[model samples]
Target: MPRFTAQELDAHRAKVTQLLDKPSIKVGMSTCGVAAGAVLAFDTLVEEAKSKSANILISRTGCAGMCSMEPLVEVCIPGQPAAMYGNVDAELARRIINEHVLSSQPIVERLVPSIEALAVAYDKSDTPTPPGASGPRQYRIVLRNCGVIDPESIDEYIAREGYQALQKALSGMTSEQIIEELKVSGLRGRGGAGFPTWHKWQLTRDAQGDEHYIICNGDEGDPGAYMDRSVLEGDPHSIIEGMIIGGYVIGARQGVFYIRAEYPLAVQRIEKAIRQARAAGLLGKNILGTEFSFDLEIRLGAGAFVCGEETALIASVEGKRGTPRPRPPFPSVKGLWNMPTMINNVETLANIAPILVRGGKWFGSIGIGKSTGTKVFAVTGKIKNSGLVEIPMGTTLREVVNGICGGIASGRRVKAVQTGGPSGGLIPEQHLDTPVSYEHLQALGSIMGSGGMIVMDDTDSVVELSRFYLGFCVDESCGKCAPCRIGGTQILRTLNRIADLKGTERDIATVRRIAHAMQKASLCGLGQTAPNPILSALRYFEPEFMERIAAAKTARKEPGIARK
Candidate 1:
């Protein structure tokens, strides 16, 4: 591997910038896109381009966050703007090559209407009427390069000022300076807990150990969340760059990416990024002609939801069962291999490079209050424009649900907005104006979990939602402790009884009782937070549970069923 000076990196970035200048066909090949048959669309584009002898570049990019409109294809014609089309199949891919690629006509039916204004300058044939000409503008810090550049291309990443942060950190800034920058940024963990990132780094830096390590927690198992996966797939180099900066800041020479095996594309891209970084001398010994050296390795999790917790993640990386232990000696104090460690989630790490590139104060000034910076949400379920949308922290639920996501689908009235996945709680529609800060959501009985915001309309049942989420938690419990394992199952059983027309007030009481025990006595976060959905549902929709109980009483008095 050749060691690169800053000048050489700049020279390389200059060369990579020209790749996007030519007419190119960039396909979104993230997991969502792949699931929607993007592989076929990509292949058809390549074959058709070759057959037509077209002077166009065929490449793959990551998800544009619009999972609902998968198999997304973006066309960049020479001397024109780049237009994105959705729901692209192989046949549509052929049309994209023949009609849009060879000719100037864009297939209006497949075009994602909201972004047309940003990409419609090239089509001088006719003024095409956009479906919905406007939408809430998204602030893209973590997701700036997503769906724009090829994830597997290191040069493309460098072209976008990617490794410029690493060069700055390694060549000029001291470790303490970097930590102070993060402190100034006011960045909190996006992995539900909302812990201050800089404080964690400072603790690990101050902690004495024989050797230090850093871990990137990519085991994002939140049901509706794919923010980390998309970032890893869309902009792998950003995460790599962030990890490298973190390693340097904490004085750790080695880092580990604890990603789930289910995310094959993310794992593949991260591995490729690591290999490329190592080869380019951005990783390994004495990075960027400095004495500081850091390396990264990938560790796959077996799809355990609990492993998203730091202690459980550390345990999983150490070849042990993915269950957490007590945490007085936190991971920062004693982590993997019994050394001081620093762990950051994928989104938190993604923010690192940007914060360094454009000073921390600039990042801090974006969002309101203590929650500074934008949050990348995997907006899914019942929303008209469901995809990945990154908004500033102080943004309200009304802005996200109504203004940005284009309101509820089918004109149905929204019942509640579920954030934080199973670990988090529900926000009733009445509180739509609540700003999406960590403190606000926590006050509403939900945590700002790893960016999974599942919207629910009137058709969704509160009891049913609780049951489904509880069932998931019960199934994913590591079973190392009794509170989570036994309490989770018992709560599920009680919820089932309520759903089955056989519940009583006593059953609901039992749920609260057991939930209290789990919350207070659970070993890990899984146990501690597993009852969140159940408790929050009980808190917000108690009438629904009571209605079931009242109906059951009425039925018992009328039928052959005996009253106990």
Candidate 2:
């Protein structure tokens, strides 16, 4: 018998409904908020509530983005507006308990303007909403449970209709039916490549293998990017459920979560969730009392950027040095000890449960064109509101930068917006109006790689920017591939010369030649896209390179700027 049956789950949900019905105070206690003193705020809120004898529920949830405004605290009264506060400290937390919870008077100055006015703007879109929505700042699906449910509480996840999708999938759908549904949804892999997800699952299902595996790629190593980490830390169960459903569909007997060791809290929470899931009969053999049986375990990566690649990750998990191997025998056909393996990143798996719950057509109707769904972007750089922003895929880059993130905070013109981490190209401000679809971004000489978006202002140097991204790839290269190793280092040297205003025009040509060579000859995606930033700088901001070299003699020579 399963530890949690359908009736038991329904009972738990009903009990949770009563818990949520009361006035509640929730604190953003994810890594971002905790770094900003959310732990103290949570403690203070609890203490103040106890002392005041307030009839309110005090709990903790994950980051709601707006990391610049954390630690955030939200007070939801029975019928009044949900008063969300930002930049909250222990003192502000106490005042919130005393004034808002105890006395019922909101502190207006502390209210988060967007949440207060547009209350349902970021609500869990439990039902399918319109697709071409630039009117609202965000429409969340993957991030629906984040910042709303307590990360440690399984009951809270259950209350939000969590494992229902897994049950629905197992009971009602065949493997082929599920794949067809995914085909209808048009859900592409969020892990940079943008490969059609249904096609990958289909490949894995059809590939002849006695044993199959499902792996969640949580080795997020991108600088200033926390979209995957945030999802892993916030809504871990969703990833677990998605993996379980995937394991059922792929006829896999096991699932693995490959997370980085650097994410201690994420690791801790996912570990706890796995234990809870196994105990509750959501994992292990005969899941939820069904004939389908699957299990999960966690493996930690040693912070290798290359391990984020599937082959490299598979190699690392097999006790080999983390490195990429040549692909044609992709992981789908031959992976993880020569068995069929399906790998999807944190964001892609998080979308699975939601898609299954609401039919595929419902999901496909959300975003514009072929890009059908919302994307979670780790918004950082010189933007006003720096943090996580999950907007529909069709939303224009201008809507994200100017409308959602509130433009450049320094009052300087945006020079470019860099997407897809170090492997991505820079989109000049003039092209910001383009929608954030896979094709749209590729046309602008950039990929929607893993959703790491960085906003750069006019004061930022294109030469230095190119050098920094190239420098990162050069350092992170496993050195197993010659083109990436040599070409990346060579391109970095040329950028250094330009940044120091000591470059000949020939240096530009040298950088371009080496970059193209790397793109064509690299062994893996790491080397192939390593020169993207440099190539992008050359493509859109070539004059900056020429002007610096042209004025090298007349302009005062300055010391090479140290890498921060």
Candidate 3:
């Protein structure tokens, strides 16, 4: 209820830090955690603590990049590192409270290791890489506060140095200085395009427009990707801080959050954070008693994957059908009702505050080449440790699959990993060790996508996977352009025919031709990249297609009574 001032931030942070030193139990209560009975766990902990008269603070926070471990329960005692337990239920929560919170002993058998604790073999190498981004306690950088702090608690977020970047930017730095910091940080857009963030801000700032707009694209409809949703649910304050900084840098009075309607919890948490921010003197007119004034609103997407594209997203935000328009006058030049607009991905915006807080050079030094800063991945499908994994940009696919995800869950030989989403290509097993970057993944016929890595094993068929991804794209196609609309359908048809065991080499050529046409002539990114999955399949597993065609040929040979 009390408004915050820049002068009072440090003293409040120190007080909160002291409060965290007491005994506490924190539950991972994001959507994944909730589905896995996190609410039951939290309830059990509260009931037990009350029954036992235990002096421990029971709270709920966001996923710690470990969705598989939910409902995760963490117990912290003064001067001791928090111990995390996974797959918790009412019984487990009670046990955690009794053994860990009341007494000092952890339930050793029920404990789950941090992401940094695993070092599974990658590509049969003696030395396997770790998803190294943080210290012994938790994941660092963009996801720094994610499993550690309660999303709805503004004080906890501030205690963890949230919004410090905005205060720093507002008090000390100019718009050009902030852009220069981004340039030094080498931060590129993480919305799958790899465009430089600083350049986008610069262009939007320089564009001649009476009004400038900022947008966060949270419409991550990728099948296995939930990076944006998690951040919005877990650490909404950080993003609010990031957006305010972005608005200040680009001289925008307003910002928009275009999130998918499927993410109810994310929507709830972000809305709460926006209100908290406004009440805390961070939003609306004259924030921090400075000239900068910015406010935000939420726009729900109808689960359309194509809206992830900038122009299509703009159209959707304007209450029209979600579709892409031509790109001659890019969004930076003219967008959102012909005003200069800067749309940043959720993950991209999450990085802004961190880059400003910890010097830009420090962030740029972490990842390799132009791919600076860490990326958050929604690791899923056929993997032992399926969850969220945030690692440096240059980390190998093999490392992500084996080292972080603990490789194939079925004990089958690791076959391939699908990066990007429905619009990304597949990386065959042979190239697993290749570094994961925009350029490196592209070289291996895959892409970094929005950071959805689906690990596939030997039992998984490339034809089937390709069919699945292409089918998703086809279903979600805006149908605005003939090439994407027709070509995607034709390619899906051929893949279906092949799966039905009634196709030949000629059919494969037809598929290739159609996919190429879709790529070259599709209206937006959805159409342009719809062929990625099939094209990558053909590039890596054409022999599988041949095998299927050979089976059809054999079936027709002398065994059949009639040939067609």
Candidate 4:
């Protein structure tokens, strides 16, 4: 591919936009989909389309974020509503081809509309309902390309206005201009903490360092979270482009993706994307024939949860054991090889290109205050349409759980929603109406940690759920610090005692006390928030704990003692 200047790139973007007039079918082929046999379905559609000489375009994309309904197949035929079919098997694939592709008739019963569809539907409806009138609707910004384009192929991504963001950033904007745009956009770090993106870039940019490195955090160890994985698998280039843009801003020349080895498909796609980008002269020295020189490589993680932390991630990249060190000399100050570094999660980086392309204010205006831009959530656990969902920030849990997720499966009452993985807290039904912003979630005792929202129904026990997450933290604890290693273990033991119906009220108080201390004194985030699940559970479900204790007391007494 020949390098194009700014005007030429704009012309090419217009050309690409015209090509989108053609119809297509996109299959959600991420890990969630593959686990539900989407690969076979993808193959079946390709094979059948070829055999029957169907003109329909069959393409494989990443997860749409609705995890519970894996094997999602989206059909888009001209003048017909685009529809997504979930829980699709080979037989269903054949039916989708026959009914939707060939006949152009939408399979309404199997159809789950995209957020775009919801917006359109809302506009047409007489009642001024929020988008996603048929069910629930969410806006897609961070995950704009996921489940919409083939991740492994750069051409598919470019065809859908993918690298256009990078071109816009490189050709039209200066580093300071780009950083200022980010500040205006109100974008924050998606890797937990919710730090402003522009401020992070400015810090590294201003920090004294001739050598700088940019790391993409793909070590997603959150138990029910796969948002990062889906982004990596579905739209790897968005991240690559985002990283490149980040490198350009921070004056960094090298980029590394610290991805966990567990996501073989994500790893494979990213590797392929890097090779494609380099071949296209989008990576390596003097990108797009510009003076900017940036190169990227992949570093596999050993699947340690703590490695998700920036310092530990840096350590793992440097061929050391993945262990976090003390902050103050933050990664921005002294990171990998003790040079200045800027680290962003896969999802956070994915947003960069779009923010630059559309301008910061455009991106910022979509969501609620402070929490600008869309967030991609891996909605799992007991929901009917569990998958990856990207909605604009400030969308309520009620809209997400009841509307988009189709509520708990089989009309079950939703018990609670768990966000931020094991280190995050649970929000009971009373707070369902609360809008999901960084502040609102934190106020409700939950942080939006990497957008892992696990919805639980009546069938789930709050105590059991807290114990499960606490147990996960206990196992994944690096043990480098006493707070995480020892305190996490103690908290788990207390929660286990409660779950096993062997606890008193004092035990609840003890759990809270330990959680407070861990939060205040722990060496790292792992140690600090390790007790979140326990404390949140105690705060929201104290009655459940009391019931367990009462039951234990009843079970311990003899029949004669009970009579007395």
Count of clashing residue pairs in every prediction = 1, 0, 1, 12
Give the better candidate number (2 or 4) by lDDT: 2
lDDT leaderboard ranking: 1, 2, 3, 4
Superior by TM-score: candidate 1 or candidate 2: 2
Model 2 alpha-carbon miss at residue 551, Å: 2.9
| Candidate 2 residue lDDT tens string, 90-122 | 788888988877777888888885443421332
**Per-residue lDDT of candidate 4, residues 32-95 (tens digit):** 7888888899899988888878888888888776666777888876676568887888888888
Order candidates by TM-score, high to low: 2, 3, 1, 4
How do all models score by TM-score?
0.94, 0.95, 0.95, 0.92
Candidate 4 stretches with Cα past 4 Å from truth are 2-19, 95-100, 103-110, 118-136, 559-564
Q: 362-435, model 1: which lDDT tens digit per residue?
A: 77876768898888898888999898888778878888889778888899998999999989999999998998
| Segments in model 3 whose C-alpha atoms lie over 4 Å from true places | 115-139, 558-564
* Best-matching candidate per lDDT: 1
Report, for every candidate in turn, its global Cα lDDT versus the true structure.
0.87, 0.86, 0.84, 0.82
Model 2 TM-score, all chains together? 0.95
